[model samples]
Target: MDVIKGLLVLACAWGFSAHSAVNMQQEAKNISDLSQSMTGSKEALNTNVISPLSGGGSLKTFDRKEDFSFSIGTCSASEVFLKILTQPQSSGRLRLLAIEQDTSLDGNLDKFINVNMDADMVCSNGIMQCTNVDDFSTCSSFKWSAASDRTVGLTRVGMSELGGCYCISGKCGNALAWRNLKQVLTDVAGGISASLAAVNPYYTMSGVTVEGTQATVTGGNAQCATGSVTDLVSTTDPKKLASYQNDPNKMKQDSQTETASSWAYQAIQSGSLNPQESSEIRRCSEVRQPIIDSAKLSDIITLDSGTGGVGYCGADCIMLTLGTVGDNYWNSPCGEFGAAARFFIKDYKRIKSAVLEKAIFDDWIQILLNGNYIWSGPYNNWTGQAIPGQCELSTSWNINPNVSFKHLFNKNGVAEFKMRVMVADAGEGYAFARLTADLSCKDTKTDTIANSCSVYQNDPECTLLEERVDGVLTFSSGAITGLNPLPQSKTISQDSCQITIQRPWFNKNRTYRCNVKTQSDLTKAIARSEKIKTSTTAKDYQDIQFKNGGIVGDSGTLNFDNLPTVQPCVQACKVRKPVYPDVALDGVDKGVVNPTHYDVTYKECSVGVCPLSSGEELVQACQCTNDFAEATAIMQIMRNAGQDMICSTGIEKPL
Candidate 1:
């Protein structure tokens, strides 16, 4: 192979070897040791904590001047926020959680501060120390001193007031811990390890616009204001993920179904069908068996009337209903099977039509009784929900209309997010997650041909069960949660897209930045490559349209505040190339931009008429590329940072 290919091979090898050899537990312990000593150390300190994968994380610094302004309350276990920061990372397997803490210290420390260490992210049974030992030890004075720890809730505050102690206190600036440069270098080279994002608590951006220099955003709201974030960074290589081989659902299928079926079977042993609401209770588990084996169907007639509310009895054990249709709640019976109500609601026809069509049906209804997402779903198996008066959604949790929740993240290691926000607690906060992965799972079932998974794939009820087992099935979720998360700046980068255009007329000043946003579905993110635009205009100083209150050429470049609410033309401009009529590079602005100047380009060609049969040329076009209709006059604009607008009016001839 060539030199380039050889380099890649070597690089990949180095990454694997370094990660495989290091011990995560020891690395964390070492950092803790160093942080404990940073309190009184004389060394100048700088603690660098980063998340290489996910965004919305941060590093907080508390100088000797003050304690955190917010009073960390003391509570038991009501829903609270969580924040975790991971050290820089390597491959998927070599991941590690750096620091985990509640946004508010209101909950009792679970097992001395075990984080979301469930099957998803691995809950450490032992206490997870929160103090940044390496961070604190960087302090020259605090490094050499001894360490002291005080625990309140899940957060342990490590204070090293004396000198000499550095690496143990878990605080930065201590002389003993961060006195070496080589160590920091090693840490920087490896990358971030592990972390997570919010579990629920959809923070809504109550509909309102907050204007800014670059863009307008949803206004501040109470929902997202309470978010807080704490982060961590490490240097050692991380652990790898274990691959699954077998279907996980097989065990559940073997045990859970048997148990459930037996319980239903034993209920009939009582013999007295009238045990409780006799008819309804009997039909509850009784009518479901025939449809599973595909022998019959439900006739859904008079749907608008009431038949849609009841369940259906199909062939074999396949019992189809509104709530338990496709991958919905398990094919369970819902609603009453008594009297005229059953006659009007039983949806037998709909089931018959569905079975013939092989349609795995799902129905979701979100009504605005007032103005809210009266949260409902594709209930394929339940009744009384769509029955206007008997709808169960009305009784469910109230979805706040004044809220707008959004999850922001980049698949790559770098990410950031921001919002004009105010929580029930604070003004605004932000979180930048890095190094995120699926630690554990819930019902992550594997399937095989012997498992009739694809046949019932559309059925939500069967999804958790019918999906054959190839490995262990488990519940999983994110490891960290950022509350009131906002941001100072967002970093966007992409190598896939690259476009550049240079002006062939006159040079102009400009500015550029790459743009990225999560798709409307929020599953994947879309990015616009580096955008280069001119930021200049001939008349940066313009006046209001004679409202009997305007001046011209003396506005000192519109600042947008005094101007009408109109969209600005462009964002950036750079005058680099001199005026060009025809040269190799006279096309787009791909060349280096001039922040404080303008780049002008020009092009000239003979144009009259195309060479007809008599050698006569006819047409109003020249050799202008990029397909511009009017090359004689270009838009006029001045490139200036302080101007109200970047580009000028149309058809302004260049000097």
Candidate 2:
């Protein structure tokens, strides 16, 4: 390689310095003349030719140990430079043998001839070098001596300069090696075609294109150029790219479907069409409800009675004094027990806002709607026991309309207002409460009508006469005209002229009738008297006729049926039942802490749809479970203390 480089540098220097003044056109003509003399042809030699294998211009190759020789001129002083340009089209190094001559006449080389080999030559001082091969900026010169005969030899070998693999016959660098290896492996394996069949497609080069210095090979199903052996191995097989065995999207879809199917199956097994209410006993219980601030309250109404023998005494005065009373304090019939008094607000839909104006009680009194706690006060401590020496206690609270109506009112628009009084050691039991609210109602109406018509015509005229009648019919009341009457004519020779008007009526439930006026014109009448016949018929109007505007009909009554009045509360509550879950305690053990002591359990009777004030056999009203109630109370306390907590269904926070 070093020797080749030194010789290339020397040849380039000699080419530029020796032929710096040579005429390019004259040299080309001389070469053409020499070529014609040697081949005995008139045409010029086409030196600018591209090789099929190398895809480069003026490419020539020779095998190793082959004798190669080319002659330019026969011992001429006027030297001609036979410029040859060589470029390797594949992965290999190019080699050129220096020209030699046998001047001693002993069949041995004695002198070397200088030849120009560069496409572009630059000269500085006395040295010449090739700057770029593609730029043909200067022509090269070849010097021939009369003392020696010129000879040239070129050799090309399939070997890469980068020391990996070399391309052969315009093929990819490793293609031939891969083929030979595959054949050897096939022979060793007793010609098992299946072992190499999968890899055979990738090794086959479909085609190659050489553009300038770059060579692109299309292989591996001929879709794209396989840049390297690694690329071919990675991209050829589609099975290695993807698999559906652990797709997360498919797994998630399957899990959701299974959950829905399980819920549906459970609903079916429990004999309930709705999955949420399946195998669950529903009863009225205290549950938190969100308040809507947009609803305004007006038209205040006061209640006078409540359950558990509690009644209104007067303004701001309510008492549960059914058993015995002393010193303005009522005693419970049972000692050391709890008594509950409930006030039902049946007009819950119309009532927008409710407020407990005042509540006076001895012992401990807790006011609630359904099961939601409204107010509890004057307790001895956090245990909710009655405070000693506190015989009379009073506290007022405002009720949230949304919370009150959601749990208290069933689908039938009835609400239960309750208050529980606990007496410890049977001292005294007193309950006094007052509630005021607002109610509203609205009404609507509609009407419809159907009308039809029938007409009878009679005409008496026995003459050759032509009669034409024309007029417009008008209605008295605002009624939609079904059809209008058109003009009619007839020619009566011997019989009477008769005209019938039918299928004309109005379409509203109103006292109205169509009045018709006819003006008969006689044309070409000869001894004839034509009597035209016409009549009007309607549902609630007397039939009449006139020549001009006048009273031509009698009025009758048109009755309209009114639709039932719609209460605003009913419309609001109807859509509420399907979405809201039934207000019921979860279970005895899960909801209430001490069920035996409090005498509270999950109600087994029907809920929302049950009738009001019925016995326990039909429907039962109950309080919310202790755990949920306590959780709500604690959350409320935390919010009041500026540490707000998020409240959700079926979620309990430790107090």
lDDT of each: 0.23, 0.30
Per-residue lDDT tens digits for candidate 1, residues 50-95, read 2211122333333233323322211111232222222322211112
TM-score of 1: 0.13
- Collision count of model 1: 202
The number of the candidate with the highest TM-score is 2
Which residue ranges in model 1 land beyond 4 Å of their true spot? Answer: 1-80, 103-450, 453-655
Q: What TM-score, over all chains together, does every model reach?
A: 0.13, 0.19
Model 2 agreement with the true structure over 1-655: per-residue lDDT tens digits: 4334433433333343323324544565566444433332212123322222222233233212232332231111111112112232222222112333332223343555443332111110011112332232322222111211223321121111001111111212222212222221111111111112222322222333333322232223222222223322323443322222337676556556656657655776676474343132211111112121221222122233443444544433333322223332444532233444434444445433334444444456555555666555454232344434443333222222222223344333223455455443334433333333232122112212222211111111111111111111122123312112211122212122222221122121122122233344533121111111112122222222343754344233222222223333311111111122334675334654543322222331122232222222321333222356867998888776543254455565553
**Top-lDDT candidate index:** 2
